[model samples]
Target: MNKTDLLKSIIERLEIDLDMIQRAAQTAYETATAEENIAENKYDTLSLEASYLATGQARRMEEIRQACKAYQQLTMRDYDPERGIQISNLVQLEDAQGNQQLLFLGPEAAGLQIGTGPSKVTVITPRSPLGQQLLGKFEGDEITLVLGNGRQVQEVVSAW
Candidate 1:
């Protein structure tokens, strides 16, 4: 999988999310200001609830905008095996049971999955527990993951 293509996909997804949020925010704002929604009494809070929804939507929109900016400004580069894994690297890991997982280390938007089937890659941020264990780890290195009450071990199969 090409890193450039992956980054492009991420940016595109973020843009789509931003567009949806903008529309929702606009609708919420309209609902909040509509004459029909105006509070008729202390017990009637339709307008107030709409306003709160609008505010939350606005905050979400700003977050998506910032995420877009972050992804756009992200620098994509080839990983050096000798230097170990880092952000922008696509890593493949194999668990003790031989199940392989593909992960893309990114600066943000963790848990976003791109592509499908074997070509699929899950975005992970350095702050994530598994991501923290993978940082600076080279191919063939073993990393342990704590899941619920069980511990699983995985080996770095490849990274680039």
Candidate 2:
């Protein structure tokens, strides 16, 4: 398939995850608020107090809102090699060392890399080590990573 077809397929598949994330976020917000209001349920205090644990409950809501926004941004995206390297971006990079990978970032750890059949691409998330390496890079610029074998690999290859 062409780039347009590939991108369209990605966008279509991403909607399923985006919808689930949005629902989960919305549920968390409502549950938090409702538990805060439930004066009769003493055990429900945990939910009411969860925000204190994760920092600000209000901030959590804001974060979920932002996540939904990011999902929306991703769902509408067409493959653009010029978007620059960063989180939530599907980037391709090549370092002086020579490791290559394709990225498809979601709100969390979720995805698969299908080779051959239809979409022959290496799937990875922004949370992975490789993802972290390619998080902020430009074409031709080098990115290197150390291995458990005491060897450093500086290989990174990117496609749009």
Candidate 3:
């Protein structure tokens, strides 16, 4: 689906904070618009040199719009944990170092220490490298994670 469709799906499935998204989008839009206005001399801000910056600022505003559209689309996906590896699933895993890390893949704000409620679940987005490696891996699976200096280790602890 397109970005708007994806956003709708995300809103339906995940426990996201809508206010945060709205605030960020608005702030970005406003900042971009203000910069554009200043650059174009639409408002009393700077010298003629300011207009040159407006074009770049306008482009930034479009970038923000595109990002919003993309993020909106993302909110509209199936968040089933008991299915194929996806952003909505909580993947409790340990790398080869035996260090267990809990990942909760939700909207940006949802990444913070979320609760363990009925609708709440840890998440790991499939787009991430670690998340990609965990896909299709079942319990008791052994894997390696590459870290600094090309060092790799086998994950032993498989507890969730």
Clashes (backbone N, CA, C under 3 Å), per candidate, total: 0, 13, 18
Task: Give lDDT: candidate 2, residue 58.
Answer: 49
TM-score of each: 0.94, 0.42, 0.43
Per-residue lDDT of candidate 1, residues 9-61 (tens digit): 99999899999999999999999999988888899998898899999999989
Angstrom error of the Cα, residue 64, model 3: value is 12
lDDT of 2 by residue, 63-155 (tens): 545644555565424334565465445555444445445555444434544346423654566777767766656655565566776645553
Task: Report lDDT (CA) for all predictions.
Answer: 0.92, 0.52, 0.47
* Stretches of model 3 off by over 4 angstroms after superposition: 1-17, 24-89, 95-97, 104-122, 154-160
Which candidate number has the best TM-score?
A: 1
Worst 10 residues of 3 by lDDT: 1-10
Which order, best to worst by TM-score?
1, 3, 2
Name the candidate that leads on lDDT.
1
Using lDDT as the yardstick, the better of models 2 and 3 is: 2
Query: In candidate 1, where is summed lDDT lowest over 10 consecutive residues?
Result: 75-84
Q: How large is the C-alpha RMSD of every model relative to the true structure?
A: 1.2, 6.9, 8.4
